[model samples]
Target: MHPQYKADKPIDCPICSMKLVKFEPTPNGENKPMDSMPGMDGSSSSTSSQASNNTIYVDPQRQQLIGVQFAKAITKPLSKELRVVGKVSFDETKITHIHTKVTGYLENVFVDYVGKPVKKGDPLFTIYSPDLVATEQEYLLALRSNKELSKSSFEEVSFGSSSLLEATRKRLKLWDISDKEIEELEIEGKAKRELTFYSPVDGIVTERAAFGHGKFVNPEMDLYSIVDLSTVWIIGEVYEYEMSFVKLGQTVEIEMPYSDKKSLYIGKITYIYPVMDAKTRTAKIRIECKNPQYTFKPEMFVSMKIKINLGTHLVVPEDAVMDTGEEQYVFVD
Candidate 1:
């Protein structure tokens, strides 16, 4: 019979003359399971009397069986997923260039510096144009004629001066002059020598091509580059080899360098440049964003995450999944 080992003392196995492994006793007076410690072997003890009689050696099989059982009950399951990198860019459609409809000197500058925000119909600059002055004169003459004919018969108002009034108003409107300006001119009965040019859109003045006071500007030279900062693009440059994972309308997360925060932007592969850049060895992809608060600026560096969906596939934690570079592995427990 095997000798029973006491919980508080190190007992020696009489048969092998070796020290037996000690363990804490459970509430039922049995030893608590220790995976590292050896257990009772069936060959050494077939009955309870034999187990406590003389001495019996611990068995390796029992330790392994307990270990297997513990692992099976507590281990977690994990799956593998794919990860990729990308970049941020601007939406080309949202971009526009601010230019002049008439050729003249940049007499005055209202939007004085670059990066100045201007709203639609907000006067950007005032230019003294001889042609604009001539148009104003014609409009004034037509207004005066219509007023004079209004005292007469409806026939004169409709036929005698209608065609002339319509013709003059069309010329002023063609030059983007608002009807309000025309009404103000008619009431004041004065010709405005300088024409005010308003911003065509809501945007920031990106480039001030407008030369200083008295600088000559023509249609050939751009006056100012107004950019709407509300929306921007995230450019994802995919290599020819990595093209499969990047499809149109894939959702990606962008990481900004300045903050720990990240933004989720869904990208529809709007434009894929047909030709590859010979120098970069990459294809150009255009991403559009609606940056209302102007958080994103031009040329701001951004990290992109392109997740490839395997469709109903399993996914694992990035830390738990061990990447051997060539392969991936995960621990069961």
Candidate 2:
């Protein structure tokens, strides 16, 4: 090409001085950089016009077009919350099994149904026992003998009828026959055919095996399984790897599956099971919680979160983060 042709079209490779050809591999319709080259003046005509039109004047002394990127150096704190799922349970220690001390037929069950709440000394059932009747008769005879012997001519009662009467009264007491029952027997001068059994603990009856309206019960058979609802047990199922964060005393936030509302409860790691579930790879941790309102029910599912402070470390917004697996990165503006 002659100098006149080059000056008019200016479509020649600067290095090799060849005719310019466009490349179509890019989104830009034309790629004319194949032949374009900077002149001896160290300037480009196309970019110069854009710089003058969109330049930002930072100070009166200088002006420059604002670029779309910036960078910041920061240190982020790594605070993590570990989430686990667990179930609510009754505190094993607070559970009581009301059993019969003496075998007898359950003539009447006043509180036979399950889920009945009872307090200490509350009548639970009535038992008709031949043995109790005979004992009561002996107590009555001892009482009458004491009154008769006191009037004896002998200054000192040889057998000590007063002592015998006291011992007899104690026998009934040992059988958990309430003082009221014993007093009634004392006043009425008759044996109570049916003894009313009272609850030994304040709790709800979770299990009961009253043999119908009229059934026999043995000392070995559990008459009723009572559980105190005032306090409950929370079993936290934590991953084996995350078990280190769980200690003897840790504050936990419990959220019920039914609703998003959370309950804050302080728990002590009273028990950590020695073994982990082979398939689930989770360890069982028992926590004691007070259910003052009895709102927490047994077998209820709950989500637990254990907060862990990893100390102050670096962090970045999720949107600004780019994870390459081997390295984490953030785009500098």
Candidate 3:
């Protein structure tokens, strides 16, 4: 038997029937009780002795070494700010594609370059189509015939000439001939070899397929793609679990990549895509922001922040929580 097991009053060890020793507290204030020793069967006696609700005791030196911290549980309003990355894009609703309605040879290129700003009715290009010229000549012939037949004594001849004139006018209009151009043609009493086409929207040209003068273009070809940048969209995705916190009209803060703290742009959530992405498990969202100064450009990456007010609730430091496989718990001081 170990000399440390010697005692004034011999007490038998429950495990080995040997003389037991009384326990003494160590300098660090930890006590090794005899009952905590292993039994004769080599089973931990403390396992059966310790209660499930027992407190876990740690010495001050060990606590200091482990860097344990304490925090008070308090009720306070908690707001969660969700940060996400987004990409700047042009507003789809404001995008316009200009396509020719008739086959023609691109005669003149006015708005020649991409990114050129243009307004509605601004001349974009001129096209020369043989069919369009023929239609114009037919309209002129009908106009001259109507004038000559107006004095006819036969009412049938007058009505027939009037019908032919109206039919020719409708055909020219169907061919995208503007009323102003038609009136000008009527005044000049001649056909223009080339007709100028104007932009239908105010925007910057984003794409131009027409190259050089006299390129043969058909109605199926997209001549120009214009995108109005007055209002732009910030597209982002959020975890599907956080979908409830997002709502239409919610204000979002957009920050440019590598921008300063004061360079945040404000926008409103316009849409939340209903479908969730299978791979990312996220839902897409759209935010609309005014870009009158053209500060935001398409394809630029930005950061978005949204604050969700969760109201007052109990809170604790994140480090305080511990997961023990089956359950989560926290230690309180």
Candidate 4:
């Protein structure tokens, strides 16, 4: 292993201290280390023309001949960005389901078409329920009886009539009858033929089951589905190994697949599904976002980015050891 002479025949490798072996010249023909043990030394440190603890210490001349480059490993902050495909969906909490409290035929529908925007207390439809009419007549009769018993000397008669009136009013309310309608009925002294149900919230009707002048509906039927689009949910899937980086309240950036390319939606992680998909081996994460003007559509595809910051860690350049598979390192010179 002397620098003054070259080994033309079989000789022992000084560095490996093994049996006889012949050295093949490097690409540059500069004398390389007799033997190199990958991952034995840190990326950078002082070196001499000696191998210690299986660390290959190359001299400056040999280092130049082999075009050796050294980089000092340093501690620095790093971050990883996860790019994934996401799907836009309605926030379940913001979705409102319309159902009738009583069975009846739809006499008239104000919100006749899907995608119609409606506010709280807006008329949805009118129903002609014979039972509702009978209930209304009972309420009127109770009202009259209570008024008659108002001056009765017997407190028991007065209390009995007042209780009947209250019970009738409560039944009407339970049937989705508004207080305004009850007041109007009291003044008119007659039950209206049609009972109208109002929109329970400010939202856009996404689905409708009632139509025409005679659509029979009951409590079990889903008359309409209205969704408040001000807030939406974006569900994204990440690899099983990457699930550790996902956490609640982490900010995420969203880009629509078919909309304006320049526009980006900001959102935050609201939930992380505990189960992983068996087929794709990915975990689902839900992000909540504000959708102004109904910018997000249900079932639409989107791209999402989530950046995870990793604390300061000792790192080096990207390089691989030839024989060593996982463990990689560099020589010190």
In candidate 3, residue 234 scores what lDDT?
Answer: 93
Give the TM-score (vs. native) of candidate 3: 0.74
Give candidate 1 misplaced runs (Cα > 4 Å). Answer: 1-87, 150-160, 258-270, 278-281, 312-333
Question: Total clashing residue pairs per candidate?
Answer: 12, 6, 0, 0
Please write out the lDDT profile of model 1 over residues 26-55, one tens digit for every residue. Answer: 444544333322353333222334334433
Best by TM-score: 4
Per-residue alpha-carbon lDDT of candidate 3 for residues 149-219, written as tens digits (9 for 90 to 100)? 98899999999999999999999998888899999999999999999999999999999998888899998
Q: So what's the TM-score on candidate 2?
A: 0.69
Q: Which residue ranges in model 4 land beyond 4 Å of their true spot?
A: 1-33, 36-50, 59-62, 320-323
**Per-residue error at 69 for model 4, in Å?**
1.7
> Residues 1-333, candidate 4, lDDT per residue (tens digit)?
334444577665475443333444544454454445443433432332344665554554454455566778879999999998999999999999999988889999899899999999999999999899999999999999999997899999999999999999999999878788899999999989998898999999999998989888899999999999999999899999888888899999899767756688899999999888999999999999999888788998999999899989987776622335876555444
Please give each candidate's TM-score.
0.64, 0.69, 0.74, 0.83
Judged by lDDT relative to the true structure, which candidate is superior, 1 or 4? Answer: 4
lDDT of each: 0.66, 0.74, 0.84, 0.83
Give me the displacement of residue 33 in model 3, in angstroms: 11
